[model samples]
Target: MLYKELVELYKRLEKTTLKTLKTKFVSDFLKSVEKPELLEVIPYLILGKVFPDWDERELGIGEKLLIKAVSMATGINSEEIENSVRDTGDLGESIALALNKRKQKSFFSQPLTIERVYNTLVKIAEASGAGSQDRKLKYLANLFMDASPDEGKYLARTVLGIMRTGVAEGLLRDALADAFKVRVELVERAYMLTSDFGFVAKVAKLEGDEGLAKVKIQVGKPIKPMLAQMAANVREALVEMGGEAEFEIKYDGARVQVHKNGNKVLIYSRRLENVTKSIPEVVERVKEALKPEKVIVEGELVAVEETGRPRPFQYVLRRFRRKYNIEEMIEKIPLELNLFDILYVDGQNMIDTPFMERRKVLESVVNSNEWIKSAENLITKSPEEAEAFYHKALDLGHEGLMAKRLDSTYEPGNRGKKWLKIKPTMENLDLVVLGAEWGEGRRSGVLSSFLLGAYDPVKGDFVPVGKVGSGFTDEDLVEFTKMLKPLIKKEHGKEVELEPKVVIEVAYQEIQKSPKYESGFALRFPRYIALREDKGPEDADTVQRLAELYQFQERLKGGR
Candidate 1:
């Protein structure tokens, strides 16, 4: 397919708000592809991403770099391009305007295809070390030189990692299911197994439903981690789990999926980005401890003090995001592995195995040691026993307790009463920062006021909840400036639009219905607790979860 054809499709999808029609449009388009390789690029490009969500390599091109690229393409100055961006409040719109108003036409230009554009962007992402930015600039400038005004708009958005077209991952799943005439449930299951929509779509189109059913866990590929919903208290957690539950310590650290095939040990974070290079000690520990030659397990990587006490959660972030001097940093902030679940062992897939049986397998395959061992857990039918277990976890500087049903199967990416998180306090939401405003008074020149958003799983987008400016120390304000200033995509007056990558935990007194936000809800007296560096925007609280919390708050009010 041609790049212009895809851009035309984007324009059509933008004209309507109904998702059913949009999904149909994409479904019909998918049936017209001439090449199978295009299948892998089409889904991600439609979402304005250069790579899959799980891939770690990014375009690295930001607003200023894009300004330079646009200027070189249109013969406009950087100052003029920046001013146009300010006027339009969108970089894509500014690029469109600049391309349409170009003084000279390129006589050597030819139509760009989807493959050409996708390949060029991949090269831009892969370029590294000395003069790599220049390499990226030349490639982007060439794309702009050939793009139509409409194509230029999307190209700019694509480089920045957002399409702004209101398309979500769920819609793509629906379209893939419809395009191949496969059962939607089967398609969803295949997706959960691989975490890659392109591969699932290809298998469905080529081998049909039977092939999807045969989808098995691969040792190297990371599956989406199964999630847990919050419970009000110990009694509620116990009741939801059929009067008996396995309570495990929930450490305040990064969750990792460890894959071991022979001596090669790979670790992926909660968001599925590979982190094996940062934590070399984990690889060594896995090498020494595991008896099986091939297996995949889930665990927590917590930073520990010299006394073996767990460090604050932020200390773990440095190791996860490590880029340089890894050996030195590893010794300074040590980490311990806490295994919780097993998904596969040897040649067998264990995701469908009952929890108690899977635990037995997990224990049987491993040689427990100080560096690598199973998590501390308890099986109890009494509420008092569970409460005491929860208190013990909290007293040990852990987060809380995780309640898992003994007979349930692991459902990737599913959150419900099957697994519940029991914390000490009422509740705190893990939200993403959508935007931020410049600080006022003594805190001037920093981004202080944050606009918070919650994820809506059905719509596959973020909805505004409220803003928070209090509960931040002066040091926090300085750190915010360093982290958020480069992520500014657009600015108008005192407010700026961010890239929506930063996640933070928020404490709020109440939830109320309000028309001020897109979700028709707002948080009352919301304040910051801490930055969530281990989580991504997609892992934040969902709108459905917030509505449930709101109803619970109302019941408390009535009882009072």
Candidate 2:
């Protein structure tokens, strides 16, 4: 397809705020994609590329590169190309314009199918990591040649990993369903259950819409988060919900959904990204304990202390980030899998069931281990009880609690009043200062926002939880950046990792289950709370602890 096709779709998507239309537009484009060349670049561009690291000046420079490319091909001035591509932030469009100007005709003429798309992605993934820079560049260049003008545009943006698709995941799900002439809900279930587009296409083809509807978490499939609801303290959420509402303890561990079939374990995140290989310990534990051939459960993956208390989020994260010598890390960290709720068990779909019902099933069916256990449960009648529990949790050194309505059904991906979170002490934590960017507007010279993260057990690394730019004066910001510059380990696009030494307290509005962050949790409105000068990285909180906090709040809201 020509880049013009995608541009037309993007324009249409922007014009309509209607959920159905927005989804349809994406599905239409996905179906319309025809370039075999685009497949090589699209996945890397959309899923692998990182943009959060670019400075304003670097971003401007990247844009200038595109403008130059466009100007070289077209008679238009560089400024005009830059201006045209500004709102879209897509360099591919400039390329498409230049091509169109040169060709004087449309270049895209075929329908893009799922199989062709996947084939291209597989090639790209295969070539990644070990491929030389020139080889990668050639691979990219070839994709452009093969892509139609519209495909070229999207492919270009994809290569840059700048997917400004107006359509979100939910909208895309809806669009895919409509495009295939199936119910939106059914399509969603299929995607959630399998976390594989290949399965989705097969289901669409084999069972039609009904086949998709039948897609429940089975031996190999698991449901994904449809929406993530996060909050600060219960009081704030209560106000957001227009007075009293149930709440749950938001745990401080990795947010994971586990699927078991007999002895096999497959783990996925709220984002539906496959993470089975990342957290092998959790998988082994689930395999030993659950032993179910077809079951899917959602819970926290945390690290524990010698005293059996939860460790910092970083401990569990380290296991996930490292590839070599994982056996030792697994034993050292010893990840615990906390099973909270069941999405599917046996042949039944529990997502439509109430929280209490699901919990009952979860408790009755699954046995907890030292590493993989059930979250604590509590019942609260009034705000006072909730408050009391919240304090109790804090006294136990937990982040907070999650409150959930007993009657609420699992609404995947939607953050509603159904679940609420409460945290203790708006205070300090031993968090890693991931990167520093120039402050915008008034905060110009000094670092205003600092990206923060707790550790992931599986990766043995720090993934973003939130950014902290507050709590620092100009002098502190300048000193902090200068002090931490030498700690830089490596640069991946816009993100810079230094030795995980600079620990800071991040004041966030609330804790949320996130797919964007690799560790599976995010802080709402996270700002720099304070710098912990006296702590080491080892003293930082772990993923397990966060999971415990989230789960604790959940029990309270469930009236456990």
lDDT winner: 1
Which stretches of candidate 1 lie above 4 Å from their native place?
101-107, 129-131, 444-446, 457-461, 474-502, 512-521, 551-560
lDDT of 1 at 439: 84
Tens digits of per-residue lDDT for model 2, 1-560: 34445446755764775655666566676555454344323222223232211101111223444445435434467676666554333456656765565432225434543344435434444553454333444434444444455665655554443444434334555555665677777776666555545456556645687677766655555454533345555666556555654444556666777778777777765434456776776777787777456788888777777776777665655665566787787778877776778888787888899888888888887766666777776655566776777777666555678777777798764546577655544434457777767566776654556777676644445667767656677877788866664444445544555555578766666567999887688777766645554233434666765675566455546633
Q: Model 2's lDDT to the true fold?
A: 0.59
Task: Compute each candidate's TM-score over C-alphas.
Answer: 0.90, 0.58
Q: Output the lDDT of residue 283, model 1.
A: 93
- When summed lDDT is taken over every stretch of 10 residues in candidate 2, the lowest stretch is 50-59
